[model samples]
Target: MASELPLPLLALLFLVILPPLCSSWRPADDDDASVSRSVFPMDGDVAWVVQVSDLHISAYSPERSADLELLGTALRAIRPHLLLVTGDITDAKNQQRTTSRQDEYEWVTYKKTIDAIVGRGGIDKSRIFDIRGNHDMYGVPYRGGKLDFFSTFSVNSQLKRLSTITSILLQGDRSYQFLGIDDTMSVGIRFPANLFGHPTDKRIEAVNSELQYLTNHSNAPVTKVVFGHFPMSFTASSEKGQRYESVFTRQSISAYLCGHLHAKVSKQLWRYHEMRTTEGHKSSFWEWELGDWKDSRLMRILAIDGGAVSFIDHTLNQALQTSILITYPTDSRSMNMLESEKWSMRNDINVLVFSHQVIRSVSARVFDSYSGFKVVEEIPLQLVFSSSADRPLFHAKWNAENYRSPSPTRYWLQVFVLDSHGVKISSEQRPFSVEGKMAIPTRSWLSYLVFEVQWEDMYRVLMWSNMAFTILLLFTPKILYHFVSRSSSYQRWVMSVLTSPIQQRKSYLWLVWFLMEGTRSKPFWSCLVIYVLWLIEMPWFWGRATSEDGEIAQMYLSGWSMPFHDGGLTGNKLSNPDVLVITLPFLYLVVIPVIVLIYGLFAEKAIVCSRRSRRVEYSAGSANTLAESARLLPDAPRALLMKFSGKMVSMVIQFWGSWTRRALLLACSITAAIHLKLCSKLMSAYGMVPVALSPPLTWMPLLLLGAAAYCTKLHGD
Candidate 1:
């Protein structure tokens, strides 16, 4: 097999298998690439900006509870110098083309949320800046909302078409030159942004003119930063692109910060050709994009120390503290105190742990600011007291004596434990810093892995067995059928119940197979019982052009909701599949054929009685006999009603017995069940969902199988 090889096949294998194996891949994490600025008091960094974007605040949106509280909490916790909101201020819910007026509810909710967050005084009105997003425009209905977002926030003074907010404080020593740019077209929302954008030549000229003025005046040493609502890449056409680099690169602008993509931390250098530049093209400008606050629940503290700019990533998920509290050394107090005191290395640090799990192991690791962060310490934390009386108080006193780094340091604790579910969980790693001469603390890493899995756990075993049992139950009827066919008594019972040819020419219709005397089940009691069950489901049947609802099956059905709708019979109703099983046996096996049989039986009896006790029979078939003998009955009124009822039933069976019609019913049921199954994207690992069929299609297989057997049972096919 190996000797006979095709060259094309061998080449195809090479083409398919080598690229991913050879290429380097990096695992994505939440914080590794994040960028933030810090206001370190020790380093004399006086100011930092916190950016939040895309607050799609709907007026009638459901409360997110704890998530809603994160914005204010994270902001207050961060204690940044200012907050910058780039775009997307409102949610513009249900906007329409005819709706000219903006929804005021969104603004009201936005104001309330912002006020609640910034009103507590750590942050205030003056420290916040905002710009209008496409949602703020009310010109085009769903695509746009209102143009008063900036005015509402009261940051209009900072709106410089090509001007700058000068002399803004930065690292206590350096002045910050903050420039603002508007790069949005409201009426079309992001439509124009996808192609050629609003013209940028005038803005570029104005910006360059100001830069010349500053250079001519020999203005104080400053750091130039620009903020905008959109990115250059958003506009694909060159003729309409914002040629920021042409002006910014000429003026030597360091960074361009924008927030429209709601992107996570990614650092990319944009290289572009400068118009009429003596220095040609260079990719020196750095673009920093921020994530959204409303959906992402993200905020950052940007700290710039001399030439080193660091971004600290923060998110709502990272802050979820479920009883895993470091009580003694509070997040705010402990780290700040350590940095303020400027401790190099100390072993006197203590931490308490009482996570919602049984402690399997606990330890602490320290990061050194000196020795390139290699000088480290690890200490096996001892459980001081663990009794049923109190929540097990485990303590870790990291011995930092081994770490002789001559700089400030940071430390974090790692606790591995088994939760009530016997699953291992690791506590969130918190970086506690001690600012010093040489502290190079890396970001804390927090995660855990389960070392073993118990295969025979009760929940796991019970769930698997349940799935096995359900699969077994589906085959039970067939299994019983095979065994019952072997028993003589069972065979006799079946023979007695099964319909037989009583008349000379028996109805060859497969529809009459599950009845007695070619009409109904043997022993009138069985026929009456089965017929009533069928009648119970009769009102659900529909004779409509639109196939949305029906007696047994609906054209359009979803989930566990619809199959049959007969509110009169049952307070709620039976599902289409349930109704199908209940009504089908009676429809073909007993109901329709039985009605025709009884009509003939009574008509023959009436004809004979009317003819002076002489027997009369028609050779044409029962259809003509039914019409002829209907008049000979003694009770004329009762006979008329029965004739009408039988006629109605015959008309239904005419369509009902056709394979095409019933197959369609079965098709609808199967389609609905399949749609429900395919619609679910995930099978949750925690809970087991049985492979049970849903409405409209659940019993399609059984019904169709019976119909198939019925149709092919005769040799005529």
Candidate 2:
């Protein structure tokens, strides 16, 4: 059983420790180091790019057809200045989705879709940029090889290399640079193994080179943006001290756009990573992740209006007629303020509204959020004549002097539009500050900022947490046994505080304690031994890898290998921290706990049954003695028999009296069931490879637990 620790103390410890875990590692101060001059000088006030990710186009699935048609239609309707397809251009799985492989047909389908769109004049081929997702690289032994369908069929491959760099020079001398980083593993192992983004040192150095944009003049500011398949958290650090985050920060990238997490998290995907550079200059960049285009039908329109970045995530559907994005005065929540803040002098509210049909009218509304979001004023916006009729840019003149504020007061802005066909749509209310000060983020923004996981910290946390938990499991029981058995006053007082009153009541203490005693069993000890061995000498998983010679099955071990050791067996094996950090924790934390609970359930039941059987045997023996006494004294025979019968009946009733133990058994069963269900969901969500793979981490726990449960019943009292 689990020894008692104060819940509040544990909670307090967690609260104290976790803040530093989340906050401490980033390098820069909140106020980024000021650049001597502007970095984003646009020919015009507005430049927008469309981003769509995780298409997962499949040849066998009927759903992909709809997605393809939608993509073509969207391209024609939106006609964005640039289109960035972040990754997962193909779903490399069979019809059952049970196995993963790089199917050429899926790539062919994706390629044909893009080719059709371009042929029909949907969008220019030069503007369309695509990159590789984990799914795209499934079973790819090497880049641009026979198995490399992406390099053969993808849009970027036809026009450029695996990674791309594009420079758009506008009407004036101003320009924008778009750098796409391809960090997918060079080896491109099978799925479940090929999860993290692995960028080589050469690739990272090349990225830095691409970012070093210099024009004829030294002061020329080219707005810089980077796009990649993986978020910084999912990306592994490169060899030779190269880091994607450091490069981006040092280069003063405007923003990093990515898409891999589909629609699992919405606003929570946004994060601003701040850190101080090696030069002691404060720097930071925003990581904006978009949802998938597969299931969510999602796409983002990212705009830079006078160097201030703003975006809107739009959902695609048949009835959806229009999309609206307010470019300037930019949303006050925009954090890229180091380069420009022209809102103070701007006299117009600029909005980009795209529609397939003729627009009837457009209007803007302002609300004072500090005054309980009461509507302050409404103004009609006039469509700019110079703007294209299809992608109409709407604006309305407003007096900036009236709304200027020295303090951080907040207001909400929303745009409403009605098309010629009577379809009405409105944009989500955006919180803004008129004085160019950062507005107080509303509930949605706060949730995103606070809850989004910082991936950079995640690798270390997962590795260390698994290590801590394993150490505890291996030693906690032995330590408790030593202290628990002792009869010192301190020990007694500690035991009373931990278990006495709480143990008497039906509480979660039962769940904890149930595993404590159960840890002595072979099933528990076996897992602990395996975990320790895996942490040190054993390989956690056996997966396939490719070399120039041929394909071979490779063993992957646990523990960290971030910079990757050179020229040894350790370097040759797949000991990536990214894979180990995830898989090791799952084995130790989730699978092992369920095993312990199930083992305890049957062990506890056998003990109770044994005690009941002993009491029955004792009662039977007393009844036989009473019968003998009654036979010897014939006069009181009946009375003696009646007394014996009553005593035996009472003993039987008393045997079943421990309802508290029954409750514990019931609680544990439910907990195990819930954990198993969660395991099932995860397995189904990620697919069957690693979840239900060989060496049997998932099913083996259940099997060993079942064996322990069965063996307990066979052992007699």
lDDT of 2 by residue, 1-717 (tens): 234334323433443354322222121111211111112233354677788899988877757645566656766766777788898888887677644678778887787888887765367787787888888877665566788888889887787544433333332244666677666765555545566776666666666765774433336456677888988767765544357888888887778998888775663376676678899887777888888877788878887766567888877755346888988766666543432333346677889887777888999998886689888889899887743444478889887666665544466789999998898889888766556666434446534532354444465576556555655654565355445545467434434434356447455444444445565454445554454444334443333333222233434333222123222112333325435434554655555565555545554664465456656786778778766767767667668675768676665545443453455456546645654664554344344354457344455555655555455543332
Task: Provide backbone clash counts, one per model.
Answer: 23, 9
Worst 10 residues of 1 by lDDT: 447-456
TM-score of each: 0.37, 0.73
Give a tens-digit lDDT track for model 1, residues 264-294.
4332212222234556634234455566655
Q: On a 0 to 1 TM-score scale, where does candidate 2 land against the true structure?
A: 0.73
Local error of candidate 1 at residue 644 (angstroms): 48
lDDT values, one for every candidate: 0.39, 0.62
Among all candidates shown, the one with the greatest TM-score:
2
Error of 2 at 277 (Å): 3.6
Q: How close is candidate 1 to the true structure, as a TM-score?
A: 0.37
- RMSD, each candidate, Å? 23.2, 8.4
lDDT of 1: 0.39
Model 2 misplacement above 4 A? 1-45, 164-173, 215-218, 239-243, 278-282, 334-344, 357-391, 394-397, 406-409, 414-429, 440-451, 459-464, 479-531, 541-552, 555-591, 594-717
Total clashes for model 1? 23
